[model samples]
Target: MSLTLPASRLRTQVASIIEGTGSSPAEARQVADNLVLANLSGHDSHGIGMVPRYVDAAAEGGLKPNSGVKVVLDTGALLTLDGQRGYGQIVGVQAMELGIARAKAHGSCIMTLGQAHHLGRIGHFAEMATAQGLVSMHFVNVLSRPVVAAWGGGDGRFGTNPCCIGIPLPGAEPFLLDFATSRVAQGKMRVAYNKGEKVAPGHLIDENGAPTDDPGVVVVPQSNGLFGALMTFGEHKGYGMAVACELLGGALTGGGTWHRPADTARTVLNGMLTVLIDPAKLGTQAAFETEARAFVDWLRQSPPGAGFDEVQIAGEPERKARAARERDGIWVDDATWSEIMAAGAKVGVRITSAD
Candidate 1:
């Protein structure tokens, strides 16, 4: 079962829970709004369902509250920072603010951030760069249970590593392409399991490496006490990309890759490699904007194909979702809501259903 709550109310409720986790009022609201925005953008996988995990991670002393990013190295266009396990919503912004300024000053900047506590949505950071008329790319790796299996391989080995790119389309919405290298995010499977639904084929494999449509294969331990794994999106191509992310975002960034058996640690960490480019500083501002606009228009001119209404850009769906969800309400599953309520109780905060 699901209940629809107004976005504002949901944000407030989530903020209250965050505050219970020892976050400041301002940090609580910021984190709450960021999670809610993910829901509004149609990516419920990265939304409020994560609150329960956050609470667990915090109580386990793995997630640090109110911590900030610490710069380890800064050389004009290159940066290395440590997140100190802080809330990703906070440290991610700090890293971007620093990287954005450097990009603007030097025409380009490369930054690596390690040890962030679940940097919610990578697209959020890309959007920040595109908003500033800069191009940005992010490669991020997850340091949690290895939930994604490699192509032609069996069992879990790595996370659903994600890659994102943002290109500013001067006169219109920017092209924001963000996706997990896996066929779908592990969190999406969590959502499906909560809803008692099955995912499409080709997205998952059972613990024995056999195929299965049940999202629970990855959500919960099976009878054998083993967990299934998500499959890579483009087979070998995606597997290769996931490896690259683990190398750059994990190894190069000093966050390290997942190698040992999945532990019971509630903390989920991320290592990110971000590159920002300023077109104006590259002496291609005018041509870049014009060409981008022309290409987008040309793409839109393509007639609707098959079940598609029209050609949509990468960022179009998220923007459309935001507009519609803002009018309607966000839906929270009964099970997820219950877990959230329990999380609130842990920190002495009371949450009433529908309150």
Candidate 2:
């Protein structure tokens, strides 16, 4: 069964649990808000379902509470920030604040952030930039167990590794394109496993490297005590993009890559390399805005094909989901709810529905 509740009630419950983990009220609310926003935006894979893991990570001292970011290196148009293993919700915003300022001042800024706990949604940062009428690009790599397999390789070799780009549009919503290089995010597999659902083929391989339709192959251990792996989105092409993300976000950002074997660690870290640009400073504001608007109008003019409503842009789905979820409330499956309650219990907090 799934429990549906208002966003406000969910946020309050999640914040209470976060506070139980020794986070200040402010920090707890911030983290809770960020997680809930992910759900509101329709990416439940990156949403409140992650709280149980966060609770465990905090207890293990892998996720620091009430921590902030450290500026490791800074130039007018370049920055290197260390998250001090802080909550990514905080560190991500902090890094963007600095990067946006520099980008606005110098026309562009290149910022790399490392040592942050799961950064949740990279598109959030892009939205921040687009809200400022600036263009932004993000490359991020996960530091958790290697759950994604390379093109022809068997076992897991790397994390999902996400890439995102955001551009401002005049008289319309910005174009926000964000995606995981993997055929699907591991968290989505977890959700499927909990819900007892089978996934489409080509998205996963068994522990022995053969294709399978079971999401549990990646979500749980097999009889041999090993887990299966997820495949890239476009075979070799997506594999190439994931590799680039690992190299740039992990290695280039000075956030160490995952070279060790998979462990049972609940802490998932992230390294991000971000580039922000201001069109005003680039002297292309008028042209860029006009061209963007024209192309978006052109794209929307296409007729909807079979079983479709209309042509939509990359960001429209998320925005529509946010509006719908805000009105209809969010739902949590039985398994995820139990896990979250258990996490709260561990920290001596109790979670109950307002209903």
Candidate 3:
């Protein structure tokens, strides 16, 4: 079952916990807000569930404290940012800002980012551009190496490979589409492990290439360096996108491509590309948004499947989740809470109970 915590309380608590990692208060706040937003959007795996891992990474010297990001290259429309091993959220926001500004001037822009840890949701970045009355697309590949297997491979040879596209929708919320190419995100596996839950067969493979329900196989080194291989979501097509992301984000950005032992790496690296466009320059912005909203309305008005409530868009589900969590509380599973508490102890932070 999901564990619930007040949204504000959770964000504050997580922000404090992140501050213990030597991140600036601003960075900590940003990271916490992003994470909490992930949870509020129903992606618990990337939400507060990541606190323990971050804390552990901080303590183990895997993540440096108080690091700052910097731009390595900028040529008006093209930019390359080096995160300097700092908080990925902070770096990601900064990178998006550059892309947005450049796109505003040039009508399109591309950015290559390096030296950051697991940047959260790609949709968040896309929405950033969309909210500013621009269209945006993003491609993300893993860093510190890849930890997922290709479609037919047993070894970890690919990242989850998430991509997103967003379009401004005027009066309504922007149209945002985001997804990971993998059958299941790595964070989902981590969440399952935290909750001691079993996942579907074929979701993971043992060292011998046999399927295993035990989430521990992905964690324990003694399992024959046993790592789980994630199936590509759309078979070859998704795998192709994943490879492309690897090239664009990893190879293009000078980050190494996937290989063995990617999981035990030092810093998370992600390569990203963002493109932004202003609809007004192309044609009529208001008309485009109105037409798009009408189509969306028609699509949702269609009949829902059995046991379903209503049809929803990519961002709608997450938006609704955030609203609900804000009123109720952010769910934190027991295992995740325990991990957070333990990690907090190491960093001179306190994890208080709901009571």
For all the candidates, what are their Cα RMSDs to the real structure?
A: 0.8, 0.8, 2.2
* Model 1 TM-score (2 dp): 0.99
Writing each residue's lDDT as its tens digit, candidate 3 over 49-130 gives 7888787777767666667667788898888777666667787888888888888887777788876777878788988998
Weakest lDDT window of 10 consecutive positions for candidate 2: 346-355
Q: Which of the two, 1 or 3, has more lDDT?
A: 1
Question: What's the count of clashing pairs in each model shown?
Answer: 0, 0, 7
Off by over 4 Å in 3: 284-287
* Candidate 2: residue 260 Cα off by (Å): 1.1
lDDT of each: 0.94, 0.92, 0.77
lDDT of 2 by residue, 283-337 (tens): 8899998888888889889999999999999989999999999999998888988
- Give TM-scores for every candidate, taking all chains together and pairing residue i with residue i: 0.99, 0.99, 0.92
Model 3 pairs in collision: 3-331, 3-332, 4-331, 4-332, 5-330, 143-269, 249-271
Q: Between candidates 2 and 3, which one is better according to lDDT?
A: 2
In model 1, state the lDDT of residue 129.
97
